[model samples]
Target: MTKIECILRPGKLEDVKDSLNKYGIHGMTVTQVIGCGLQKGRKEVYRGTEYSINLLPKVKLEIVTKDEDVDEVVKIISQAARSGEIGDGKIFTYKIDNAIRIRTGETGEAAI
Candidate 1:
């Protein structure tokens, strides 16, 4: 199994989720996060005072799938999250040793 983690712009969440659903990959965990990368954050002005916001809001999606589906899943996420600009975020994959569904007591691929 493989675990795919995607960090994307908050505005792109719905697009990514819809794309994944169309591809039949539905189970996932979504989280609101703060991070900084190549975009290096941004500057803001509040009450006439300028400030640097180094950490930006982001949306994180975690999905676990069979190993063979990794490539397609990554492609779907990439296409959906891209904006032709910096801070588009990143995607990462990790090998999953095992998975267990607590309620059903299912394991391996079945558990996912």
Candidate 2:
């Protein structure tokens, strides 16, 4: 199995979710997060002064799927989330050892 994590602009969440559903991926975890990279954050004005906003808000999406679905899942997120600009976001994919469905007591792909 594989776990795909995507950090993206908050506004793009719905598009990403819709695309994932279209691709037959249903289970996911969403988290609000703050971080910075090449964009280096930005400056904001509050009151009459300018301040450096070093960390920007982003939405983190976590999806787990079987190995064969990795490419399609990534493609769905990429197409739905792309804004052709910096800070648009990033996606990370990794292997998952196991998964369990707490309520149903299902495991592996069935659990997913």
Candidate 3:
């Protein structure tokens, strides 16, 4: 199994989710996160005081899928999240040793 983690702009969440659903990928975990990368965040002025907002809001999407489906899933997410600009976010994948569905007691791919 493969676990795919995607960090994307908050505004792109709906697009990503809808694209994945069209591909029959319905199960996922979504989280609001704060992070900084190549974009390096930006500067803000509050009441004439300047400050660096180094951490920006982001949306983290986590999905566990069968090994063979990894490529397609990544492609779907990439296409949906792209904005042709910096701070578009990133995607990471990890090999999952096993997965278990607590309620049904299912394991491996079945569990996902």
Candidate 4:
């Protein structure tokens, strides 16, 4: 199993979600987050004043899937979230030790 986490521009959430659905990836966790990397954050003007917003709003999408699905999931996210611009987003993958379904007491791949 593997866990894939992607952080991207908030505006791209809907498109990414739809793409995942097309791939039959229906389960995921979405979170609103704030952070900055290479491009850092951008400056904005509010009420005639300029301010540096160091923490840009981003959407974090997390999904757990079988090992074989990792690459496909990452590709789907990348294709959907990309804007050919900075702050498009990033994806990270890691191994998942195990998972269990509480109600049915199912474990491992069966639980998923």
Best by lDDT: 3
What lDDT score is found at residue 66 in candidate 3? 94
In candidate 3, which residue ranges exceed 4 Å CA deviation? Answer: none
lDDT minimum window of 10 residues, candidate 4: 34-43
* lDDT (Cα, tens digit) per residue for candidate 2, span 40-69: 868899897999998999999998999998
Model 2 misplaced regions, further than 4 Å: none
- Tens digits of per-residue lDDT, candidate 1, 1-112, equal 9999999999999999999999998899999999999988689999999999999999999999999999999999999999999999999999999999999999999999
TM-score of each: 0.96, 0.94, 0.96, 0.92
What TM-score should be assigned to candidate 2?
0.94
Q: Per-residue lDDT of 87-108 in model 4, one digit per residue for the tens?
A: 8979999999999999999999
The local distance difference test score of each candidate is 0.96, 0.92, 0.96, 0.92
Which of the predicted structures, 2 or 3, would earn the higher lDDT when compared with the native? 3
Clash number for candidate 3: 0
* Pairs with steric clashes in candidate 1: none
Model 1 — which ten-residue stretch has the worst lDDT? 34-43
Compose the digit string of candidate 3's lDDT tens values, residues 74-95.
Answer: 9999999999999999999999
TM-score-superior candidate, 1 or 2: 1
Query: Residue 66, candidate 2: how far off, in angstroms?
Result: 0.7
RMSD of each candidate relative to the true structure: 0.8, 1.1, 0.8, 1.4
Model 2 C-alpha lDDT versus the unseen true structure: 0.92
